[model samples]
Target: MTMEPIGTWHGVTTDELGCVTHLELQDNRLAGEIPPELGSLSSLVRLELTQNWLSGGIPAELGNLKNLFSLSLSINQLTGPIPAKLGGLSRLFTLYLGFNQLTGEIPPELGNLTNLNGLFLAHNDLTGHIPGSIGNLEGLEFLALQGNMLGGEVPPELGRLADLRHLSLANNRLTGRIPSTIGNLEKLLDLELEHNMLGGEIPPELGNLANLRSFSTRGNDFVGCIPAGLRTAALNDLAELGLSYCT
Candidate 1:
């Protein structure tokens, strides 16, 4: 049965031959929990269910889709912990679960996704330390865990992500000194760690970030003079430097 172009509730649709590979139900005002039967679609590669009113925990059955490469469930009212079963999607390259009401610690199993290039979990009610295993995503270029209740020191293992360009951990309960190893992100452009409990002097090693364009550490418990390199022409090229509320 071919899907009608008009509108439908559950947003269920299928190809003319009844074979499904890609399912897009985004912005259709979809409600209710996603059907766990969707896991039976072994060939499904992309699932877009964003911008809807869907509520309930993501089904663990989704982990059965071994060929699935992209899964986007952002901008919805989804709650509950992200299923650790999702880590079984070995081919997944992009995972967007941001802008939801998801709580609990991010599953460390996600670190097993070595092929993931983008992982967004921001704007949620998630709490717990940022997983150090996240550093295992060697291919990841964008990592956003901001706007949550996560607390603890910034993991130095994150320095292992040499390909990372944008890293935001702002507006959380994070504390402890900024890891000096952050200088390892040579490709980093935007780095935000603002509005947290982070203290101690800003690391001088951050001056080594020659490509950094915007850096913020404001609204924290940081003390001591700003790194001298931050005042140099090298870092002056930054578009923004937030140091307000620091001593």
Candidate 2:
């Protein structure tokens, strides 16, 4: 068998109609931007290019793939907003686009991907609020949106996602009270909401998150005491529930 391209020039060897099922180019010194032509591969399922030096925006043509399941492009230098066309990927499960220079709002169109599981868009320059459409993701498990400039209230619709387990929304400029509907997320285990401008009472409904183990909200503008139920109920792991600057 001929030697396969292993390190930097891996994707360069990918041929059209090569029937590749899994393409993992993560952390192999792959530099430069992703080729837009790769979208022609209709058979691709898992495509991982994380932890590389890849730059430039993700190609909008990637939406052409109707069978892609996992798409990982994290820890790269990719810039520009996520393409709304990516919403065409209905079967996608995991989407990792963190640690980049991506800007603009979280696309509401992404909510069309009802099969999505892990949605990682943290450590970028993204702005705007969490889209209410995200509640349409009935299968989402992990959602990370920290270290950005996202504003606006936590969409109450997010509480509709019964499968959500991890949610991170710290270090942003978000305002408004914590949506009481969040208490409906019984599967949530880790919830982070620190360093924001949110105010108003902590919703009593959150006390219903019995699966919640870690909750943080430091340096916020919240007023009134902690939710009575949270201070005394199943969520009373006070040490693990770091709170600060509540009015």
Segments of candidate 2 deviating more than 4 angstroms: 1-18, 231-247
Identify the leading candidate in terms of lDDT. Answer: 1
Candidate 1 wrongly placed segments (more than 4 Å): 1-18, 231-247
Candidate 2, residues 74-180: lDDT per residue as tens digits? 99999999999989899999999999999999999999999999999999999988899999999999999999999998899999999999999999999999999
lDDT, model 1: 0.86
lDDT of each prediction vs. the true structure? Answer: 0.86, 0.84
TM-scores for every candidate against the unseen true structure: 0.87, 0.88
- For model 1, which pairs clash? none
Q: Residue 235 of model 1: what lDDT? A: 32
lDDT per residue for candidate 1 within 1-247, as digits (tens), equals 6465422425444556555768888998989998899899887888999999999999999999998899999999999999999998999999999999999999999999999999999999999999999999999999999999999899999999999999999999998999999988989988888899998877878767878777776677766656644543333312234342223
